[model samples]
Target chain A: TQLLEQSPQFLSIQEGENLTVYCNSSSVFSSLQWYRQEPGEGPVLLVTVVTGGEVKKLKRLTFQFGDARKDSSLHITAAQPGDTGLYLCAGGPHKTGANSKLTFGKGITLSVRP
Target chain B: EAGVAQSPRYKIIEKRQSVAFWCNPISGHATLYWYQQILGQGPKLLIQFQNNGVVDDSQLPKDRFSAERLKGVDSTLKIQPAKLEDSAVYLCASNRLRDARSEYFGPGTRLTVL
Candidate 1:
């Protein structure tokens, strides 16, 4: 019941290309978050990966977390068009809700065409 | 500083009528959330609050859905009767219940149900 699978879903680059997005899960997450929404707004937090081979960056956007924490990724260097939008990957507050309960991933819109 | 806050950015209703949505968080953020976006997916934690009460709502839809925050800051979400898949896009988020994580969202409330 704890699922969070994301992949291509949709992408359209064409300007200063470069991309990567994924988030898989079999279960096991203490933290992991990454969001970016635009049309109408809502998601914004762009990074939050806890331990597990952690790696975070924001300038060029690059985040990775997965040493066993399940999975996570997002790399978008150089992209443009304001970096398009829609890109999410959430994991937990799990172990039974409240510790941080979150479990979303079914997104990856990206467009970036200049 | 001020971020999470929602209202009637849009609504169309007709299915069965009845609708309500609102939220205001980010002042102190004692943890609060309510999501249900469904256009492209991603974002679906029906309920969660840690200051006014409920720690999780399982996934909401408590028959027809209902929510509140009492004093945990501000919140409300009702949907009795509506169903056309209940349209969707009703988000509100916050965090800081001791930094259990880090969430902050808003600017949602699309609902269309017709």
Candidate 2:
């Protein structure tokens, strides 16, 4: 079973639209991270939330870590074609030390059409 | 600063053949990771190394897979008698020791087993 589950495996929206993607898990985590990946490339980190109930904003992107620390959400306001890519959420377990391993969701593929 | 580098961005091999992928992490990074990403799924950690020593490799299939990070700078992953299911994108990522939040990744090597 996948430790992390992502909703809306695929999403296509016109430019200027707003959208949200979710990542959920039954197990609690110490930190959750969001990443974006483009075609023919590796994923790049977008944000990291360490405290529950924390919310972070990156330009047009807003990321929230659930109060329970078991879920996360990414909301894009006025999405643009450049936002087209795969969104991935990864969770770091609490038990592991500082160099903890990460568990990743299957990911959400977002296609923003111009 | 140069990003993580990977060789042979694409590889094609027949089942039962052997293949290898190489990775060179960014300078000063002490932690390295190898991940396998099947189609439509997030990258799965196969092995992790810290300064040339194996840190975590629980998910690696020892029967047909092996990896090495000699000298603690660059790493290589090898698969012997490759299977169809092993066809996937192999990604390499690295971070400063004990800093799991700043991972940088390579473009990855896409492998196809015929």
Candidate 3:
């Protein structure tokens, strides 16, 4: 089973439009992170939310950690073509050392038309 | 500072051919990871290393896959007699600390089985 599930597998929008992606999980996480990837490139870290009920803003992107610490969301305002790529949300490891593994969502692919 | 480095940005091989990918993490980083990403899917952790020790490799297919990090700074993932199902992008990522929430990733090596 997928530890984290992402909604809206694909999204296409105009350059000026806005959108939100969701990542949900059944277990608690010490921290959650969002990343973006371009074609033929690895993912780049965008933000990390460690506290439940915490919200962080990075330019046009806003990230939120759920009150229960089991979910997270990414909201992009005035999305640009540069934002077009695969957006992934990953859950932090449950244990220390070897178990410090990351579990990722299926990811949401966003395409912004120029 | 330099980012994570991966080799053979693209690889095309026939089924049953052996393949190997290399990764060099950022200097001073103690945590390293190898992930496999299939088309249209998020990355899945194949193995992890902490200072030249195996942190996690439970998801790794030991029958055909093996990875090693001798000095904790560089790693290599090898697949012997690769199968068609093994085609995907192999990503290497690292973080400054062992339990850091943020991870830096490389451009990844895209593999295709003909």
- The TM-score between candidate 2 and the true structure equals 0.97
Estimate the TM-score for candidate 1.
0.34
The best candidate by lDDT is 2
- Give a tens-digit lDDT track for model 1, residues B25-68: 88988889898989989988898888899877988989998998
Order the candidate numbers by TM-score, best to worst: 2, 3, 1
Error in Å for residue A52 of model 2? 0.8
Q: Runs in model 3 with CA error above 4 Å?
A: A95-98
lDDT of 3 by residue, A1-114 (tens): 339999889999999998998999998888899999999999999998999999999999999999988999999999999999999999986545535577899899999999
Two-way lDDT contest, 2 vs 3, winner: 2
Clashes of each: 2, 0, 0
Q: Give the Å shift of residue B33 in candidate 3.
A: 0.7
RMSD of 3: 1.3
Model 2, residue B14: displacement in angstroms? 0.9
Sort the candidates on lDDT, descending order: 2, 3, 1
lDDT of 1 by residue, A19-86 (tens): 88889889888888988889988998888887898999998888989998899889888899998988
By TM-score, is 1 or 3 better?
3
